[model samples]
Target chain A: MLELVTTDRGSDAGNSETAVTFERLLDLISRGDREAFSELYDRTAPRVLGLVKRVLVDHAQSEEVAQEVFLEIWRTASRFESQRGSAMSWILTMSHRRAVDRVRSSQSGHDRDERIGLRDIEPDYDEVSETVEIRIEHERVKRAMAQLTALQREAISLAYYGGYSHSEIAGILSIPVGTVKTRLRDGMIRLRDELGVTS
Target chain B: MNDRHDDDDPRLSTGAYSLDAVSPDEAEAFERATDASESLREETDGLVETAGLLGLAITPVTPSERMKAELMAKLATTAQLPRQEPVAAVPDASAEPESAAPAAPTPVETPAPDARTASTAPRAESRARSRWFARPATLVAGIAAAAALFVGGGVVGTAVSGGFGTSSVTDASAAGLAEITAAEDSQRSTVPVEGGGTATLVWSNTLGRSAIVVDGLTPLPDGKVYEAWYIDAEGAAPAGTFTASGEGTSWHVLAGAMNPGDAIGVTVEPAGGSTTPTTDPIIVGQTA
Candidate 1:
């Protein structure tokens, strides 16, 4: 349900080299190069910590977790495979997963319980970005999200932002698990298509 | 019967799976099917990458100065600096007899490889092992004791998967996992997540192996995965990534080594996992 955009905005045409740079740094880390690891951490820690903070919403714990995330990158730098994904995606994916794990482990009883009652209410997701590129990317995601059906958007956001599982989302929405799955898939596909994210 | 339209339902759940929203059981089934279909893998990868943009979409915030310093210090300790002297020069003090050993008490149970090799090690020491496995508390204690031996570096080698490769390493890891899960003195802790769920950390000292059973946990969005960690006062070591088990619970087998008094933690990390933990721990269960 997405309209094809011919615009050059948000395209990865120029950022391909950045991915290689990260891969190269990871490769050096694998060979026991501390300097490369430091460099990699400098370039990605903010991006990594940002996602963690957003998901966790606790500054103190976020810092603790961020420290753990970077330490992990140092220990497992050898495992990074450039072919599987871009360095940014690889690094950010790690950040998001770590954040979600924290959310699920500690917040399930309290934070999640509070969220269960308020599942219908949409979160105010404001990205305060000064960078032109990030601003555009945020706008693109916002526009794409707006086009999804309300149910689809809710299902996706609940899982995406709330970090709720399919069954959890179903329980919150009072819908069948199958329906939850469908809406999540449909919304994501639409979003992907809208964003022209063919990577 | 007419062709079933629902046959495609599983394929479509790629979005859910990519987002870490699929139940563990369904995710496994999807993983198997995806293994047989390259197109599905590619499609899911693209979707996951697109989801990565969602993280980038957030406003970037600077980490605390103390965090950077602490992280750099932690990394410095863990980094394998070049050895100025040969291993022979160290005299393998750890290899000496009890009298030759340092006066300080050994914090961990160091089982010498020559003394108790993995092969000669008893596979089934007692039927109590099975019974202990049935009960969470008993199982946890059993694993904790077992972990002391495992992390003490007496095992043949630490059982770790070499990245995401499909090799015999998987078989070794699977076998190692079974041993660790079955190890005596294994311990477990079920901690509450913020919203409303439980994450069970089960680990063994003998095999230095651990697994986490996540129940009623929320799934992550695309571009993110759940990363396990073994944390102590020094810092954290990355265990690995995992998904749900489809039984409303996901079981993750930890790969990194653990020390006594170390706690098992999980955080929402990037798909692979960050070198350090970036988010607050959703749950942390003490091992020692």
Candidate 2:
């Protein structure tokens, strides 16, 4: 059983569709697939680690959590159902849980305050240059996001990457909570329009 | 407003933002809206993907090459490895213990402790045959009086084959022979510094080397050692100590070899021989 999400025919004009194949590989891995799992690890580890690095902010802890999340994926892949979400969403969600857990485990707020005063540990982009799949995904999203102004991207990244709740984002931006809500919603609409998504 | 009256509600946008869907927030409003909107569940997913992309932007500290090896080793050790059968278990492969047998050279040292075989007959013969071993003269003197019956022979002190001078018992073949014959009990073959023999310990003045042939004596107690004393023929001062063994019929000169005028007498003492005799004389032999 597959849950298919319809992308705008016009918007996804150039994705090579490896995402579908990736999902298939994930399915095989769910069946105790060794080689498939290895392939999956090869393809996804960088991205998973990259994501975990953002929230956890510690390279060592991030990588460690990434491994744990992957192992968890291997163990619980059987429970994944197509109806709930895409394979990509499921894997990212798993990474989120592990990253958040790592964040909580580190008790790094004081230490974070002491270091550079940077709320979110900015990633080392020069480290893992974008892969083909990530590049494609990035291209699709950027095109959709192009509809929104640069201010919108900043707003979204701060909220998402910074883990700032809406109220906190409002306070950080020195704006009203209502204004933060408007900017976020409008930003999403512009993204949908730029991407030409049916929804 | 929909069932969710607030767009900037954290519940709505937080998950989506955490997911990295909107990619980034341009304004506080959009950021909060994304967090508030449950409809953008998948969009919030981008927060993490964005996290990944952002993570890539952070510097990487390269762990040493050995660190990776150490990691692999740890992985192998703690892999919760499935149990393989003993035959299949080769250690250094994942976590299985190495099943290979240890090397082969351990069984040969078990038999010969004294560097001599147990079956040797010299160590197994009658008490009188011990005289061939050579022993101390004092032991011979004691045995000359006491061991005449023990030898199963009609001859009494003649058992000592010492080349002694001007003694009533003047058998050249048997002067120290009583000492030699007396120590033969232990001299079963591997004679302990051969005791109860006829010949005295002949001393070398320069080297202090004394070699006495003794026979016919009892085996010395283990841990209880025998000390050889080099007494001047006048029988007063001690030269040094020789290790005495209560083993078989044999001549093992202790340290401080005898000079021409010195006599070799063995006294029982502690394990490593004492500086001087603390116990009574077990055997005293005059050497040739």
Candidate 3:
């Protein structure tokens, strides 16, 4: 089968650091805080929207999942503890999971041509030299991803973006369950080290 | 199969974890540990970075402003729905108790245009519409399928064995499949490709139609969708368009007999159906 690529519209100009702060507004949101929610939505929605577009690849599904992600944040603000992760992470995670669900729900496994690997897909490396405000931050994240081993890289990606669980990843890769575990363990440590995320 | 990773949230590896590779006990164990520890959460963050990587792979396209508007309209309707309570008629402000609370007048222009939406708003309670989720239809505004036929059921680069891999094949080729007149009665004529899934095309002369059923296929990404193609000896031509009907499976039928070719193959193309297939055939067969 030939490669079928689905292009997106925006870049992650917003750095992970600022994007990470979207959670502050969640508190206000639970209290039905209006201004905070607006601020939160402005900073986070673009990336969330982008994330949805990357996965579901359908405009309608992207929009639908976006709305649901926001609404979910509105309704479940209390469950969001900053200790869990960044606000951007929470929101983007919501968008990804929901998009995956919709994608999974719609297709019944006949065709599997969409092999959109992150490294294999985008055109940013050449454009990395381009002047963008978020370039430094974006590069930092990319560099962090590079530090991990290939197994760590592939394992984390499949589990995270592929939306497959441990068992699923194991089945796809044909690796033993133990290898999946340690790789994921080491992958997270490497990611945290990359993010400079120290508790 | 009841291993530590299976019983714990061992960050989703691609291979062994692609499907129900584990036993019930193993999956249950994994779920329990996933819930009990922060392993899943940490891995979740890494997943975002991975998602970021996936985002990078997408060729960027400028979105239309109209798409944004359409979505905003959709949000306004959905937003107003939860808060709306059906009423017999559009009511006036006369029935409210005036107090320390600000004077609530009957809204001249209801936020949502739908009748059901207007009726659903807080009856006489009339809370200010300034709530973040409750923006004026203006800010509340936003905006957000096709089947075409082409040659070969595109399924190139699909996740055949890699745990965390993706394919460039569009799901569209599944739609344009011409009915195979010969295989109508076979209960299991469809076959699975070495690529980790199965696909089948059914033909029915009475209905003058053909339909393709794909199972175990991987799901697609957003914005970029897949289109189906019908193959003819002349070359690949647009047959129709199809979105994922559900699961890792899609069922799409041709409008008429796909007599365009002596052989049929599947490939991945752009969102709109391609003039010809650019990918390899995920599955193929000749029409009887």
Candidate 4:
């Protein structure tokens, strides 16, 4: 079931070359190297745009936010700290935050609630053009996600992919806010453990 | 699984925060709480990294070709922030102090307005009039300083000379520096030292951690060192002490958790270090 909307991006865990290249590119970008910024944008734009589109589901707005994300990356390249996390994580985390912010700020409660009402149906993943590397990661994440209980999976999906707040998720799932928080937390911890993510 | 009422458990919110599932206010509160607890912050970072992996689960989408063209064109006008050394290298006598300091103080230097602001300025005048638009350069400098704080994780190099063991103190302070800078509510202030250098203080009120980076100050003579202090209404408390290297740059993680409204000050003291500051502060950066 998870495979329906699952496909991986080019870089994933254990790919040290991509990580090093990102860090190196950021280092150069910080020094005003336009070529490095261009390269960095080319490498990460698809994932950035993909993640934004997943949360927003609006093509034009998704593109706008993706552009803003790239501009932010360009302006704040010096802020990338290798010690805290990977360059890719930093970029994607920023992208996700921006997308969520847009969703929360732009949409009214009624509109968001209406969207949440229809959240159970999964979005189709484009499988025709994906690479083998992407499929491997998709399967790995799908397997890990499969381990989550239905409630946990539902809570995580609404919060992450749907950009819904816990209270809104509570409203959608008809559970108490506290219960929603617990489910989200437990679900993430389980996912982290299953994926073998280490701090 | 039991439906645990874990709203009060701050740790639970780490997941929501990582997923950007909480409201901005909740995220702020979580960040404040996480700032105070290193373990919580570490848990949050781990979860955030895990959530980032979830981003890769979707199929890739190629943006319109014009997007890249527009971005490339925009890049021609945008000014990239200056690079900062993670750890201040051995002071070079030939290097200009002004050049060594990350981000100059002038607000006029950061030309090229942000693309979003530029695009929306005419239509959304109210929205475009944010603090960022008013003083873009200052905002730029603050961001640069914050970024410097992150890369400056090892700014604790001088702590070794201050009598703390080299490896352990440096490692602990580096981690602390990273935590404070990464905190959502972290604040930074830069003040010019009396002697010619500048001291940039980065602190998080919730985390109670602060560090100062001093640049361009004249290297102190033998038996004299710079002492840091946390000053509030009642009195001053000694933070730590360290001498400037030959190049006149020093980074020290102030000792102990900071109290609310405490201001960070640095004064020169004797080599062994003083229990109390013996002279006037050469520089004071308010963290309140």
Candidate 5:
């Protein structure tokens, strides 16, 4: 039976728990184990869909992209190198890239200039569940985000979540394109450090 | 102006690129730099992984139920990925089979709905034969016959041969394609063209590479090639151009940066290609 999980019980168990388990699941999937692939999909699809939805914003397109991502995982299971990082990270990275691509290729690509023309508009914050673990993670990112200057946070969010390029973010923020790039770089570096991302 | 920035700190943008905060043009430049240096690619992968963690900050939302069902249906009919040695097997294997239940019924339910998924052979061999039979003389009738047979038998045969174990050139390319598809940064789109042909575009803006493959085209005239263009409202920008192999697969590598609003198009041109398309585009695919 497919266990439909509403939460990441893996997180509650600890980071290593989910990370190691997901790694093993990917390994089994590589060995042509369809069951293991299902488990991996169940465990990761929520965040994958969530991440894609955050970027693309359209429900149907997000689903389409998410489906393709999973299909890719099925085909490329052997390519997952455990030495690189956790399976969740790999899956999320794929979701983010695919979603960003969908956004960039869609009408948003051309319409972006108009959207970015709206200077000083607030970036949309994706709604989060009030669950303790999720809230804790969100609060951690928020705290790390607090360390950035307002301009830095704005620049990072607009680019990362809004799916706008640096030039587009620059237009939106009414800053030099160079300034937008610098702020985004610095903000990501700080955020990475805050999250203890050694890589 | 850009030259000085490159000199000051060429790698400074790696952070932003990892976050996908840069334009496609900037991304192409960043990848060209990274591709030349293995260490640079590793560093970029690390940064991308780091940035990917921010995804956890978003509240998880479950996808629709249809997704899982469709995925299972696709997997069941399609040939499974080639199996590797069970070297990576987990010792606590008992837990593995429990999750296999939902996917088990798929193979029984959907035997062969579509030829593409129904055929168990690696894409190259199957595609080659399919294209040959699909040539103009008997094109439509041949495709119909092939499709009917494609669904009738191969599924059971391939399942039995899942990994009897032999490596070949085709397997190697399939592996490479898998790696590309599995790449965290790659994007893909498949579009159907005129005369029952299909085109697939797989590109990685971060890698500074794009590939377009047109399959099942009726054999073009000798000394002719299909030219590719990146079209926007302004006009067409020449992408790399190429001729199809006898099997009717034409592959083009596009190194130029692509922006949003750019759609990929193909036109029949003389060998090599022209400064501008010489015919109406036979196929056009939107990029976004």
Candidate 6:
């Protein structure tokens, strides 16, 4: 029976165990274990869908892309190397790449221009309905993001959340592409320092 | 549009690459550079990890129940890529056998199928096999027949003993061999021995296991045995050792999970088997 818990209920503050569990599930899924796949889906579907929806901004299309991401995860679970990165990082990276590909391939130049125009007015991350642990993570990330310079924050946000290329970001911000690249690299270096992300 | 100057340093693009903001061509070039540099790869991996953290800021949205049902159904039919061990850099001078003159084949990338959920999506099954079978000089007869049996869908759930007599295989190994051969996704490859006879390598990606059956090879002397090896992009790993009967037939379940692009090789070794191959492979079965 499927446990239909939408939120990450009972998640503790420190998510150290979550990484191990995801890695183990991926190992089992590599062996064609269906139950492990189900549990993995149940645990991660909400975030996967949420991330896709954030980038694509179309509910139906987001669902479609999310489905593809999960299917890719199922097929390539064997390719997940824990030594390279966390399982969550691998899953989310693939999800982000798929969403970005869809956006780049399907959108017209005019649609992109319209999206660029609307980027400044977009809403910030929603916090009201999220669980306590998620809210805490949201707060940590929010605080880290606030440390970046305005241009750094805008460029990183547009590239990541908006799925825009560095050139597109340069066009949007009226800056040189080189400046955009430098800002992105410098900003991410800062974010890694701020987030204390160790490889 | 002289953006060439902007990307002069591939390291500059790591941030954008992690965000999936680079064009596919730029991404490919950046990946090539990253592959050659260890520090750059570490930096990129760190930034990618940091980028993944940004995903958690969004509000979680539970997918519709129908989507889960469809995904589960698709998973039931989908064949997974085989697990791959990390490729360790080995000194080519010492690793390569003098007699085996063919250069090590480059690893082929198996492209994931497009996002379309079509049930009949074409897979990279042949491409996977072509990774190890790149040199035609290494190939021999019986491949067409094996491929025909695979395409005709006549091999699934067939008795394992029927292909290679189980008399030489232990009861436990025979059972394991049967389980792998019975799997729906099992694949078979044949390699003719250098001296005489042939070896058939059967494996299932779904089961992550493999078994080799040898027939008509000259029986080894009392102090010598045939050692099986799982050769991947890194180097050769000792699988197990077995001896042929007077009739020169032997079967053994390979040790450890079979990685993608691994080729099963048989070499003559001392009775206990060496950590590394002491002689050139007599038969190398290129497995998908």
Q: Report the number of the highest-TM-score candidate.
A: 6
- Which portions of model 1 miss their true places by more than 4 Å? A1-20, A112-127, B1-9, B23-29, B76-288
Question: How big is the positional error of residue A103 in model 2, measured in Å on the Cα after superposition?
Answer: 2.9
Off by over 4 Å in 3: A1-21, A34-36, A108-131, B1-288
Best by lDDT: 6
Tell me the deviation in Å of residue B169 in model 4: 61
Please give the fraction of native interface contacts (Cα pairs under 8 Å between A and B) kept by each candidate.
0.50, 0.02, 0.07, 0.65, 0.51, 0.76
Q: Ten residues in a row with the worst lDDT in model 5 chain A?
A: A1-10
Clashing pairs in 4: B35-B207, B91-B247
* Model 3 chain A poorest ten-residue lDDT run: A1-10
State the iRMSD of every prediction, in order shown: 10.6, 17.3, 13.7, 8.1, 7.7, 7.6
TM-score of chain B of each: 0.39, 0.28, 0.33, 0.44, 0.38, 0.43
Backbone collisions counted per model: 93, 130, 110, 2, 2, 0
Error of 2 at B149 (Å): 59
Per-candidate RMSD, Å: 20.2, 30.6, 21.6, 22.7, 19.3, 17.6
Docking class of 3: incorrect
**Higher-scoring candidate on DockQ, 3 or 5:** 5
Cα error of candidate 3 at position B251, Å: 33
State how far residue B226 of model 2 sits from its true place (Å): 46
Measured on C-alpha atoms, candidate 6 has an lDDT of 0.67
Single-chain TM-score of chain A, each candidate = 0.79, 0.67, 0.72, 0.83, 0.80, 0.86
Each model's TM-score? Answer: 0.51, 0.39, 0.43, 0.54, 0.53, 0.56
The regions of model 5 sitting more than 4 angstroms off are: A1-9, A12-20, A108-130, B1-4, B7-9, B35-43, B76-288
Query: Per-residue alpha-carbon lDDT of model 2 for A1-113, expressed as tens digits?
Result: 02113321112336645443556766665554444555556555665776666665666666666766665655455555554445655676677555654443456533543
TM-score of 6: 0.56
Candidate 6 regions with alpha-carbon error over 4 angstroms: A1-20, A108-117, A120-123, B4-6, B85-288
Which lDDT tens digits does candidate 4 get at residues A7-112? 1223544663345367788887776555577667777899899999888877778888898788778767877777666677788898898888888887643454
Q: How well is candidate 1 docked (DockQ)?
A: 0.22
